[model samples]
Target: MKKRKIFFVTGARSEYDIMHPVLEQLQDSGEIDLQLVVTGAHLSETFGKTVRNIERDGFKIADRIYNLLSTEDKVGRIAGLGSQVTALAHTFNREKPDIIVVVGDREEAISVSLTAAYLSIPVAHLAGGDIANDGNIDNSVRYAATKFAHIHFTFLEQHAQVLKMLGEDEYRIFNTGNPALDKFIHCPRMEKKAVQPLIEFNIQDEPYIVLIQHPIITEVENAGDQIKETLEAVIASGLKCFVNYPNSDAGNFAIIENINAYATKYPDVFHLFKNLDRVNYINLLRYASCLIGNSSSGILEAPSIGLPVVNIGSRQRDRYSAGNVIYTGYDREEITAAIKKSVFDEKYRAEVKAIRNPYGNGDSASRISDVLKTIALDDKLIYKNITYKVF
Candidate 1:
């Protein structure tokens, strides 16, 4: 039998990390030809040019789309999305892959799905049906991608049901859990001493926090203030912090500015990083006293490690959590209280450690790979029908 060519589009470090396990499984399969298209923040120097990490992982790059705009605002973001669509259309026309796979609700996922739909190509969208009605603009983008996607690989059964309500055919949707959890589950925990050198922090003896807050698109003007509140709270907690850079969204520049300012002002208490490979990041979470941020990592991966999360603002408001996350607003006092509860409250900490992660069982990659290998590539898969009943 001829091998099926599968194209996977990854735009940022976080998205790539979530999709890595699935990519590995597909690449190792004898019946599949995996093509990875690196684009968005992966190709931008300002975002640490994470494409190097992909190369370091030893996956052969099929193409690179330098579509990210230097301007960090809403207008620039839209322009970049348009550029991605144009670039991907040309690449897809040249490659003509049997299937194109994308993950999450970022611009990359929607751009690929939209372009593929226009070209009559089947698109497999992972994490399509998840909801995070946190005024981040991604919630709407996620649903838009679902409409264009031919196959849905959701992380939860509830998410799959969201696709069904969105008119997606049931046969095309698969509850493969989250492939991100596969990496977290199998990753061995490193001792604090071992992790300290990697993150450049002395965390062996003292408790610390992992902070990863991002800018909310709907509240772009308040981006700087929002992060300031979180930083102040984390600082007040008196725990050393390892702060990761926010994603390349519209309001990210403001968040980055605040992060840099905080890092400079309190160099001893706060450490800033552009990026960390998945291994270091997972281990960082494993040993952290608490995680403070609105990044999806807090909602999805942190719980699996039994890490308490103080999810600030609305970026992940409606997303399902495993009782390990504490949601708070943008007020510094409220944020500080949440952090206190997450770290110093012994009862809360114990309960969090005992909670089982509902995300996945670490086999999502294999399941997704199996479906990709066997799902028939034909008109039935390409032409989608609404599964909704009008009566």
Candidate 2:
């Protein structure tokens, strides 16, 4: 029997974190050949050189296409997509795989999916049908990928409904939950003693909040002001804050500059990191008083750990909200109050503790693998038939 080959393309640490389990499952099956393509922020030194994390996990990368640009502006993003399209076209032509698996709505994923569509290769997209109303380019890019994709794996039923409404065949859409949860559900929490040596600062006896705020592409100009507001709130709260750098987006330079200035001014209160291994990151979330940020990690993963989240701004605006998440505007007072409520309000804390993660069960990777094992790779599957409805 011929081994089925699936090319999995990952661009950033966040997407790679979720794709790890599914990659492992496919490799372990002994029936599927996993061709891993590493690109985007993973290769950049500024982003913690997270490709090292993949290597440490003992997976061989089939290719490392240099698709990311040093510039993070509007023009740079368009150039980056062009580079990815050219690189991926060559990659698919040279190493023909039966299927292409892409997750999320990042530029890399959208580029790869669009390239595959032109190449007539079947593209399977994960985490589709979610909404981000913050005017992030990802929303429109995500829908475009869904339209081109042959299969869709959504984390929630609502997302699946949205996908169907967008004209994807219901039979080809699978609600496999969020694969990012698989690691959190299966991996044991890192010991505090072990985690201490991994991070730059020691964990305080007092509770701390894990903060990860990124620039909203649409509101790129306000990125600095937003970070400043969040920084002031963290300082005023008098709580120890463990913060990660913002992602490589249009206005990231402003966010990075603000982070650097904060670390210089409040060295003791804020512990900054470029990246933390998945286990240690989850461990931080597990022990944090509350997860504070506009990051999807707070909305998707924190609730599963029974952590309260103070989600700032509209970056994650229409993604499903758990009772654990307190949405606030990007004002210093609003952010500070949200943190205080997340930490000291007993009634709110109780509500958060009782909330369930709407994402999924722990077995999402296995379900995705099962679908891959049996999915037929043929003209019938590669060619998408748009479902039309008269509403």
Candidate 3:
């Protein structure tokens, strides 16, 4: 039997990590030939050579497109997208796959979706149908990708409904849950002894919070100030803080600068890491007092582990959140209160600990892989019709 070639495009470390399980599933199954394309932040040294992380996981990379500009500004992001489209055009022309699978709301995913749409390739999008109402360009890019996608794997049923409302066919949308949480479904949490060697700083007996803030490109100018507020709030909470670097987004330099400045002042209480292995990262989240960030992980992954999250600012604004998340403004006082509430408030902690995660069961990769294994690869899928619904 001829194997259907399924291509996957991974741009940043976060997307690669989230989508890695699906790739593993497709590769493990004998039905499809897996083609992995690495690009964007994966190639950037500033992003910690995260492609090595992918390589370390033993997936063979089919192509590497170096499109990310050294500068992580707005113009550079656009240029990177254009470069990706051109490079992927060459790749698609050379190795036309049955389908292209992309995840999340990054520029690289948008570029791949657009290129596949133009190339008449079936595009499967994961984690669509959710919106971040903030002024982030990811909102528009995500919607555009959804419109171009032939198959949508949304994390929640509400997201699938939103995709249908956006004119996507009901039959083509699957509420498979967040693929990021799949690995944690039955995996045992890494004990402190196992995770201790992974980080440079000591995990003291005192409670600590995990902070993973990123810059919203629309609010780029205030990125530094926002990080400062979070730092102050974390310090005010009197807990040790584990600061993870921001994504390789346009305004990340400001956040990095603020983090570096804070590290110097509070070396004892503030621990910094460039990046953590997947196991170590999840272990940190599993044992953290609370997660404080604008990262989607706060909204999507924290609830699965029953971790409390204090989400600050508008980067993740208006995104679907679980009961475990506390939304607060960027002001230091508001952020401080939320952290204190998430950490020390026993009633709130009990409520968070008892809530169910709206994101589906952690088997999204298998659900997506099963669909891809037998999905019809024909001209019909290439030419999509708007399933217009009367609202």
Candidate 4:
């Protein structure tokens, strides 16, 4: 049989790290021909010029869609989606790929995957049926992406079951584990000192907290206030706080401004980072006292390494979690209490350390690739029955 041609679409700070191994194996192995497409933050200037990072890591980008929205407002976001879909439609026609692979539920990923779906290309949707950030399009994006795609490649077995409950074809859905966890399990925990240079920190001596908040798309106006509460909580707790930048959402600039101002006043207390490439991120993540964020990493990536997470607010509101997570409102006191308890409580820390990740082991990339090769490519691939939601 001839090799299958798989095209991958990624946008703005989704877990590109998760796909690293999958892409590498597909490219290196003779069975699959890979065509990678980069859009979203990969092409944005305000987002650390991240596209260069994609190329620096060594993968072929077949399409570079240029649509950088200034304000993180719904209008700009929707417009950008319109532009991206148009550009990728051209790319798909030229590439004529056998299958399209999209990861996560970011707006850009949804747009690209939708483009592929409209063109009648089979899509392999990863990280569907997970929950987080109530206002975030993540839940809607993931679920909607699931509707358009053929294969469901979820990060957790529980998530796969949820997809089946949501009416996805059980035969087509496979629990490949999270691609992000693959990096965590495969690589040695990066010594805190080894990653110290990435941040201008004296973190080699003691523990620290990592902040990774994304702008709430639904409440774009109050983002500055929410970010203030997050910062105040970190400062009030007196924990060594490492601030990771937010994603390129409508109100992302406000979050950036808050981080910049926070960096200036706190000095050593703040471990400033532009952005971390995936491996260094997972490595350092293992050592953080606790992750303070509304991002999905807390629910999905942190637990695999037995890392503790203090998830704040509606961002990750109703998500599944490992035993290591502590949920609290975004109020400074609530955030502070959660952080202090998760980090300083020795007995609790030991309990968290003993808990294993409920998500799968490290064979996700391989298993996902195995199914991509074997699944039939026909109308039956695209057509699926909607299983009734059990009340």
Candidate 5:
């Protein structure tokens, strides 16, 4: 049998982590020729040189393209996406792989998905049908990726149903949960000796919180004000706040700067980790007083571990949540109040710990790999007809 060529695209650190298992599986498979196309923050000098992380994980790079914006602004983001689409169209046509596998909702993936769809490549999208952030652009991009994609791995069965209702053929959408879940199933319990040196802290001595909030790229003007209000609330909450690095997006420069400045002023209460491996981040959440902010992981991943989450603002306005989550508006008082409750309210903490996650039971990689193996590759790709019935 002739080997079918598969081109997997990686745009962000987290996406790379989620897809790592599939990459390895495909590498070992005799029937699939895996070609990895890496771009976006990986190609950029900033963002910890993401490509290094990929290489360290033992994947050979087939193609490397740069689509980083010159400035972190609206104009820069638009220019960068346009750059990605143009470059990816050229590369995808050159490789002409049998499948284009995409994951998550970064703008880089959006650009690459458009390029693949135009070139009529069979796209396999992972983690579709979930919603998060009014201004994050993920909801629209994820929905758009689903239509062009020939295969999908939603985080749950209901999400798969939603995709089918959106006109996707039931066969094309699979309920594999989020591949990110695979990371948890393999997580080695962190020892104090190993973790203490990994993060610089007064953390072992007192309570600490893990926070991740990216720019609401869809809304440019509120970036600074939103971070400011959130910072004020974090400080007022009276707990040691450990903020992680934000994603590289337009308006993120200001947010990063503000966080750094805030850290310098209140070194004891404010802690910042420039980068964390996914395992460390998970372990930290396990011990954190509360996981706060708009990161999708807080909503989807934290609940599985029964971690308390204080989700804020319009950033995560539409995502599904479990009992572990407590939301608040962008108001500083509300944010502060929510944080205080997560730390001090005994009943609320107990309730959060008892809620089970609706996301997955951790077999996403195998399920996703199976779907890719079975999908039909046709010459003409179009949306399949859906059967709707009157109730």
Candidate 6:
């Protein structure tokens, strides 16, 4: 019997981490020939050249697509998408994999799904049907991927129901939960003493905050001002902040500029990083007093460890969150008060600790792996139909 060829596309550190567990499962299945197509920020030095992280994890890269543009604005993002579509179409044509797997709503997801649809290859989309009406282009991109995708693996039952409403066939949709949590649950926790050397901060001696705010595409011009508000709030709270750089999105240059200025101005309390490995990042979340930012980690992964999150602004506005998040706008005072409540309120902390993560049971990788191995590859899977039903 010939092994099934499964090709996975990863564009950013966050997307790669989310898909790592499933990638591991597929590689270990013995029934799969896994191909990894690395692209976007993974190949860019400005984003830490995270392709090395994948290589360090010991996965053989099938190909690398260097499609990230030097410009950091809306025009650059669209141009990068066009580059990805062109490059990925040629790659998929040459490789001819049994299926193409993509995660989340980034440009990579749409690029791969769109290319695979044109090539008559099945595309499996993870984290589809999850709503984040954050006024960013992400929501539209995610929903568009859903229409092109042949199989849907969502993070929640609610998200699966969303696929149903979107006219996706129920049999093709699986509520496999978030694969990122699988890694979070299984990765060995790093002690504060060990974490100190990695972060260069004495987390054991004082409470610290993990900050990861990304720029919203719709509000590109104000990205610098928006991050300044977050910086002011975090600084005013007087907590040592371990800040992460934003993703490779439009307006990220402004956000990075503000973050750099703040870090230089307050060297003692502000620390900035391009990226951190998954284990170190998870452990940082484990020991932080609170997480302050608009990154989806605040919405998806933070709750599992009972970390209090002060989610500032609309990047994650309508996303479903566990009981651990406190939503606030871009106002400095409002963000400061939320940070205070998250970090200092013992009662709120206790309540947050007691709330279970609604995402999944950390077995999503196994479930997704099983489907990929067993699902039949035929015309039925390639040709999709809208499953409209009377409600």
Q: Write one digit per residue (lDDT tens) for candidate 4, span 1-391.
A: 6778888887765567767778866777768877788877877666777777778877778888877678756799889888888888899988899999888777755786788888888888888878664777767888888888788888777788888878877788888887666776887766777888776677777778999988877878988888999999998998788888888877788889998898898886776676677777776777788998887788777777777888877888877777788888769999999999988999998888888777767777788778887789999887667767657
Candidate 6, residues 150-192, lDDT tens digits: the string is: 9999999999999999999888899989999999978898778
Which candidate order results from sorting by lDDT in descending order? 6, 1, 2, 3, 4, 5
Model 2 stretches with alpha carbons more than 4 Å out: 389-391
Error of 6 at 178 (Å): 0.5
Cα RMSD (angstroms) for every candidate in the order listed: 1.1, 1.3, 1.5, 2.1, 2.4, 1.2
Worst lDDT 10-window in candidate 2: 196-205
So what's the TM-score on candidate 1? Answer: 0.98
Candidate 5 residue runs with Cα over 4 Å from true position = 28-31, 132-136, 379-391
Model 1 misplacement above 4 A: none
**Per-model CA lDDT versus the true structure:** 0.89, 0.87, 0.85, 0.80, 0.78, 0.91
**Hey, what RMSD does candidate 2 come out at?**
1.3
| Model 5: per-residue Cα lDDT over 1-391, one tens digit each | 8678888898777688778777766677656777788987777655777788677776767788887776866788778779878888889888788888989787756776778877778888888877665756777888887766777878878788788778777767778777776676567778655675777776676676778888877666677787888889988987888887677778778778888899999898787876577677777776788888777778777887778888877777767778787888778999989988888899988898888778776777777776677677875344445446556
Once fitted onto the true fold, the runs of candidate 4 whose alpha carbons sit more than 4 angstroms away are 384-391
**Residue 189 of model 5, lDDT score:** 73
| Candidate 3 local Cα displacement, residue 139, angstroms | 0.9
Task: Report how far off residue 25 is in candidate 2 (Å).
Answer: 0.8
What's the TM-score of every candidate structure? Answer: 0.98, 0.97, 0.97, 0.94, 0.92, 0.98
lDDT score for residue 148 of model 1: 95
